[model samples]
Target chain A: MAALVETINLTRYFDIGRGQRVHAVDDVSLTIGEKEIVGLVGESGSGKSTFGKTVVGLHGKTSGSVKFRGETLPQSYRPADFQRLASKMQMIFQDPYSSLNPRMTVGEIIAEGLRLHSTLDSKQVQARVEEWLVRVGLQAGHMSRYSHEFSGGQRQRIGIARALILEPEFVVCDEPISALDVSVQAQVINLLGELKETLGLTLLFIAHDLSMVRYVSDRMAVMYLGSLVEIGKADAVYFDPKHPYTEVLVGSNPEPDPELERRRPSTAIVGEIPSPVNVPQGCRFANRCPKVLEQCRSVTPQLITLKDSERQVACHLYN
Target chain B: MTGVMTSPQTIPALLEVRDLAVEFATYGGTVQAVRGVSFSVEKGKTLAIVGESGCGKSVTVQSLMGLIPMPPGRITAGSARLNGVEVLGCNVINGKDIRGSQIGMIFQDPMTSLNPTMRIGDQIAEPLQEHRGYSHKRAFSEAINLLSLSKIPEAAKRARQYPFEFSGGMLQRAMIAMAIACKPSILIADEPTTALDVTIQAQILDLLQDLQTETGMAIVLITHDLGVVARVADEVAVMYAGKIVEQGSVDDIFYRSAHPYTLGLKLAMPTNDPDKQHKLNPIDGSPPDLFAPPPGCGYCPRCPFSMKICDSRPPENFEVAVQHFSRCWLHHPQARISPAAPSIPRELYVGERA
Candidate 1:
């Protein structure tokens, strides 16, 4: 498979007052193959969303490069640049309540991208909007309805239609189903999977749910404190996690089984995540790592591939 | 044993709610938030009310706590008794006095729930001062102890800091410390772990379990997460459109579910099994509008095995097994004689056992 989207040493930093910078994304290099779904899992404030946004040119990169189809994208996306690439790569936001514009109708919201990027007239744009709405499991008649009239699940479907109307090859889906109800979450996930099959779309699915991510993605990447700790085949990373953080994260996720959940020993990770502004000198996870080594406190571990397997891990134990 | 009390084997429940019905009179119409919800909480046991966002789980508990504002919100019909004393529809049980002393509560968002202006210790100590009549100095010291009990390291230092200084996990721990400060007999945690991360959520759940075992207090956990309910709850109640659609033991709900909504909820979750990542079977369509709630079953529109009777009238509770009740028309005896009745596939609901 050809590499459709590649980020080499991508870094994004947010500057606070008094010369302090929040290292939201730091030296993160990842690749998404053609028609592949790469799942990104991390705790809140771990910079998973920042990395996704930076990849799609939603945020200007502080350092490094993003390559789409072997063509290097600009460091900062201007209006013309965004207009040019709008048809190639798109993004789906996390919050359904605030993502869609309330003033605009669902039809106008979905058609905005098509109108901006293409030479479609009013009739053609309306027709395309209705088609995309129906494609996303919503009725064509729902195009004229306001966002407030729909449920959280319906609003999310509208968000998906708006992003996919342009027929982008690669999309950044940032926790698309997290805001949805438990019953409706599966509907969105299955819809995304089906769309991936029919449209051959590559995705960077970012979510906090490890189990859900493994079900949706071909490969899984674990991020911690603005760094990628592990990346491997989704099932391999979930079942046979190599990194200490991945192990704890996967273990902590409760299965929806009564007997199994009750019988499993409760081993919660100790200590809270350190502030990104003042990141510690050593490994980011050293403070709370159960299997911490002496050197782990002073030497930062780089992400490295294992000797016999395709799995990559960032831990002193692996070394 | 007192003459007025019942026999030892038939001891009254610690907190018993019978036919709990709550209504919110909105501008559009009267929203039947909770219609005839009934359950009991025993000593040292956990009963989880599982449902979607607008399924009336929150309203049921909120009405009991007097948290619901009047004029618009009213307990149309119901009785919640604590220790054989009527707690609902009475002027004696003011929210301030009985809420902290007898029944403590925690909310979903710990950040917003905590008092940001006051020190963490002061907020925790307020309940002790008001309920237990403790001095400021003594209550503050006890607050630190309570923090330590909730597994926060350097409890003394943490209590002195404001809410903004603590991490989300620590803030939740602080909230837990405050709720358990009075050592209430019944703890009503409304989605306590929803806002926290997975690791942090696990820690909170573990703390709740530990506190329950140590104190021997009953817990009424309200959440939409089935995994959390499976881990913590001994009994499970599935609510839908303001009704208790199903009530059963944890094993009964998971392994042998009778309600279609419960089964749909279980099936909708992404399976952990790698070999069977099959297409998930989602209960299509949103829930019914509560402004003019459906006259029939709330799940009638969404149920895969919907019958004519399900759309016309609600079904009575049928005892499927010992202590297991499902409110569905399919459970009716005459339904088997009806034409084209689809039997619930038992294999789908039978989860893998250890």
Candidate 2:
């Protein structure tokens, strides 16, 4: 199957004054199949969102190539290039407050993308706007109201409506449900699931919660210190995670069951995540990994697929 | 942190809260933040108050801590008795004395809670000087030790720096160091790890557990994360729309949940554990508005199995098991036992492979 989106050695960095530079996303290459939900899971400073933004043309790539539908996207988006790309690829921001134009009514917010991408008439646009509002589980009356009038979950639905109005082939959802309440989080997740199935929309679901990612995504990718640690089927990575960081991530997730939580062996990884600016020379996670070998301290392992399996892990133990 | 400080020999309960109600008077109207909330934490036990935002979990704790202001925010009714003293109604609120000596609080954001200009050591040592009457030199030395105890390396040198010098995880450790400076009997941590990364959160949770073991102080944990509640809490109180919908031991709360709201929340959260596999059944709507709280059940509007009486009269506390109480008509024996209880799939609660 042809990939909907592909990247080659995608790297992004920020020079934070002086002689220092923060390596946000370093040499990451991945492919997302058509209509597939690829979940990106990582902790803070893991650069999952940075990678997502770079792919969606929100951030200029420091160096590398991003291909959409076999066409290489420009590293630095020009006005015409970005506007053209915006119709096919869109991004839903993590924060609901800052993402949507608070001044615009919900109708206007959803219609902006449609207006830019399609030539639907005013009557048709209004009809689709109201339809989208209802589809995302909002009342038609909510269309006239501003984002500030809605709750976090409702605002997120508005965000979804806006992102989908363009009928983008791919969408990058950056922590879309993290800010929502648990009850509302489930609602948003289900909404996304339903929309993905009905519209055949491809997604890059970026989140920190491994559980959520594992549930929502068909395949999951783990990033650590701005690099891919593991990528496999969500169940494969979750059921038997390969990388030490992935293992720690799976272990570190607090089980909701109290009995199991108490009974389970403690797998809390020691030490904090190293600063992205001063990342380790060899394996980025070597400083905190429990199974660090002598070679791991001096040589960084490349992500390699295991024999007869689709799973790929970047760790010396597998090699 | 000392269990000896709140010895049960002196007082029957470590902290007793009875029918606590907190109200906030806004220009719109009086918002009932907490209504008839009650729970108690024993010595060395952790009571997790679990709820979503606007559910009054934070307000209930703030009310108990005597942190609420009088004019706009008032403790309309109820009593919080600590050490044989009625601490509510601002009667025993010797701010520095009570809070500094008897109880300590750790807010969600460690950065904002800390003073930017002040040295980290001085901030941690302030409680030592104020409550314990320690000298400057002694407090400084103790603050360094506290920092080390929080697992921060180079504590002596780090203490001389400002809050900005420390990272988020480090700053949280510093906050813990400051909160426990006096070894207070109760440590109230409100979403201490919510802002931190997953791996960093584990370290913080571990640190809290270790501190509890050493000091033997009861902890009142207020958080929205069910996973966090499961990890740290000995007892769990599920809150909804400014009320305690369910209160029980960890086992009862997780294994044999009685209330529909608790079940909804449990089912709502996605589990990474391969052992539990099922489609998530999210509750239909958001929580009720506290400004004009429904006369009957606050959860009636959202409950999947809401009975007719659930909307008109608030369900009385029905005991599901010993020490397990749920405020839902579905659990009441007198209420019609319609086969359509809002129970999550039984398979979800069962552990097959574990």
Candidate 3:
């Protein structure tokens, strides 16, 4: 399989005043294959969103490189670089209510990409926008409606149509369904799946919901405190997680079955995620890990491929 | 009759709401937020109100707590009884005010709900001082004890810190400590753990269960997540368009859902169980507009099994099982066969990773 997007030791940091820096993404490497969906899951403040944003050039990388289709992207995106990459890469933001311009019509919002990246006239762009709207299960008449007029689900569909209008090969979705209601979340996920199939698009799906991510992705990666702790096949990582953090995470995720939930023992992790600004030494999850070893508090583990298996884990236990 | 099945025959409910109707006078028109919703909660039991956003789950509880603004929001019709004493339509209930002393509430976002200017301990103590008439020193000491009960590490040290000093999970623990400070009979948690991570969410939910067991207090948990509802709820009320579409025990709702909307919700969720693998059948359309809600069933446009009567008039609650009721025309004896609750959908990955 061809590598669609590759990040080699990608790191991003925000420099606060007083010589302090928040390590949002720290030396993380990941690869997304052509037509493959990679789900990235982590708790809030664990830097999953920052990682996605850094990979898509929404945030400038402090170090390392991002390679798309074997070509390296700029460390800091300029207007020219963004313009050049606009048609090939796109992003679906987390909050649908705030992502789209409130003043613009749905048609104008969807057609902006075409207007910026292509030579299409207003008529041509409007036609394509209407077609894409219908493709995403919305009516052509909805193109004239404002974002405020639509519900959360409808606004999300509009966001998808806007992103896909450019026909990008790779898309980074940052918690696209987290803000949505539970009933409407499935509709957006199914829509993304259907679109991925027809367009043969590769997606870097970033979300906090584990079950939904495992259901939609080919592979899953777990992050904690700006570092990848586990990456493996979706089913394998979910059902048989190797890393201690992943084990606790999967165990703690609540299932929708009343019998199973009531029957299972409580698997809550002990403490909150350590502050990313002042990241702890050694393994980041040691404070809350039930299976923590003394060495886990001092020695930072490297992501290594397990022998005789395709899974990669970063933990003292695995080592 | 509105949700008479909600009142079980064995024991009297600690909190009972009947024919509850609430509306907001918005700029567009009157938004019938809670349209004849009714349910009851017994002592030492949990009743979860589950629905999509804007479905009136929050409104129902807010109206009960007398938290809604009077001018913009009004309780058009309803009767709330606590231990057979009238709780609604009065400023006070049997010489006991209901808001904090009888029914305590914890909101979704702890940061926004908490006072940034006040210390965590002071905030928690405020309720005790105001409701229980405890002295400042006594309330402060009890606040530390409550924090410890919430499992906050170094409770004394943490209590003195402001809300900004606490983490998301810790802040929620502080919120829980404050809500139960007065040991209210009914605790209303409105999406308490929705803003926290799954790991932290598990902790908070476990703490709530432990607190309920300890105090024998009834809990009204309102959330949109079925997973949380299944985990914490003894009885579940599914709401749509400001109405209780279905009400039943957790098992009855999950395993033997009789309403089309309930079945649609189950089918839409992605499940890990391999035995139920199939494509998810998502509900087709968004909920009806509340400014001018549909004259008939609110879920009719989105229900796959909608009937002619569903579009013309709302259906009455039909008893499907013991203490289980569904408001749908399909549950009518003269109607066609009821749709079975689809088992959880198993997701199959179609692509091979590199």
Candidate 4:
């Protein structure tokens, strides 16, 4: 099957000043198939959000090519090109509180996308806005209210309504449920999963929660310090993680059961994530990887396919 | 085994919070931040209060320490007894005298909680100087010792540095050091590990557990994360809106919970258990508004099993087992249809095991 979206050696760096740069995303090449949810998992400073933003044209790529439907996207997408892509690709921001404009009514916020992307009449736009409001679990009465009037979960639903109102085929959900309460998080996740099936939408689900990614995504990719460490089927990545980083990450998730939590063996990954500005030349996770080798000091391992399998890992131990 | 001493239950509670009710006089109206929240902490045991952002978990703990601001907020009801002495609204002894010296608190963010301009050593030593009447030199030396006890490497060197100079994990460790400097009988850690990464959070939890063991100090853990609560709490109180809908031991709350909301919250998290491949059963609606909270059960609006009477009549805590209790209409026995289970899928059945 032809990939819906593909990136070749994608890299993004921010100039933090004094001629030094922060490597936010580095040499990442990935493919997203049609109607598939690809979960991008990583911790803070892992650059998962930056990678998602770069792909969706929220940030300019420092290097590498991004192809959508086999058409190459510019390194820094032009406003016209980006505006054209806005109808097809959109983003659900992380912080629901700050993402929506407080001044605008919920109806206006959801309709803004429609007004920009389509030539719908004002009455038609109002109807579409109300329809989306109901679709995302909010009532028509909530349309005239301000963003601050609703709770975190309600605000997130508004965000989803705004993004999907344009009928974007591909949406980058950047930590959509992280800020929500546990109960509300499931509602949002289920909504996203249902919308994926109903709308045939493709998603790049970016999150630090490993277990949640396993549940929502068809395939999962693990990134560490601005580089891909592992990628494969969600079950394969979660259950049989090949990379040492992925291994600890999957194990570090605290089990909800009290008895199991007490009995589970320690899976502590020591050492804080290093500053992106001062990234090491070798493996970025080498400092914390339990199975570090002498060769890991100077040599960086590229993602390599395992024998007779689709799993890919970027650890020298596998070699 | 000291036959003179009985079981842990008989041991007088180190800190007892009875029917705490706090109201915030907001411009919109009166916001009932805490409504009849009652729990107790025994010596060396941890009682975790788990709830979402505005669920009164923080307010309950803050009220215990007399930390709630008085102008807009006031404790309208209840009493907190420390070793049988009344603490809440007690005029005999100032609450401030007992706050840091006896009932110490560790807030969520260590950076803002600790004075920014002051050095960390001084910040940790302030309570010591103020409460224990320790002089500058003695308090400074004691602060370094406390730092070392918290497992901060090169404690003496780190002590002289400001709060910003230390890393996040280090700052949390310093906060622990400050909270425990006096060896207070009760320690209230409100989301202490929420701000740290998983690895750092684990380390902080371990440090707190170790400190509890060494000092035999009761810990009042207020947090929203169920996993954290399960790992640390000896007893758990599940809060919603402004009330504890369920309260029991970790096992009772997790395996045999009676409240529908508790079950909903549990099924919502993405568990590591491989058998749970199906979609989570999310509670369909947002939490109740506290400004004009429903007169009945706070959770009646979102509860899947709510009965007709639940709309008008408030549910009280019904004892399910020896100590396990749930505040729900389903436990009323006669209305026994087991309030309709939330909209969980049939394939991903929720009550199969419970």
Ranking by TM-score: 1, 2, 3, 4
Candidate 3 per-residue lDDT over residues A1-319, each given as its tens digit: 8999999999999999898999899999999999999999998899999999899899999999999999999999999999999899999999999999999999999999999999998999999999999998899999898999988888999999999999999999999999887677888998999999999999999998998998888999999999999999998999999998998899889888888888899888788888788998999888888999999899999999999988999998977
Candidate 4 — which residues are off by over 4 angstroms? Answer: B1-11, B90-95, B338-354
TM-scores of the candidates are 0.96, 0.96, 0.95, 0.94
Task: Indicate the TM-score of model 3.
Answer: 0.95
lDDT of 3 at B313: 92
True contacts kept of each: 0.79, 0.82, 0.79, 0.61
Clashing pairs in 2: B1-B183, B1-B184
Lowest lDDT 10-residue stretch of candidate 1 chain B: B1-10
* Candidate 2 chain B: worst-modelled 10 consecutive residues by lDDT: B1-10
Cα displacement (angstroms), candidate 4, residue A37, comes to 1.0
Comparison by DockQ, 1 against 2, better one = 1
- The lDDT of model 4 is 0.86
Q: lDDT per model, in order? A: 0.89, 0.87, 0.88, 0.86
- Specify the poorest-scoring 10-residue window by lDDT in model 3 chain B: B345-354
Error of 3 at A284 (Å): 1.2
How many Å off is the CA of B6 in candidate 1?
Answer: 22
* Models sorted by lDDT, best on top: 1, 3, 2, 4
User: What overall lDDT, based on C-alpha atoms, would model 3 receive against the true structure?
Assistant: 0.88
Task: Compare candidates 2 and 3 on DockQ and give the better one.
Answer: 3
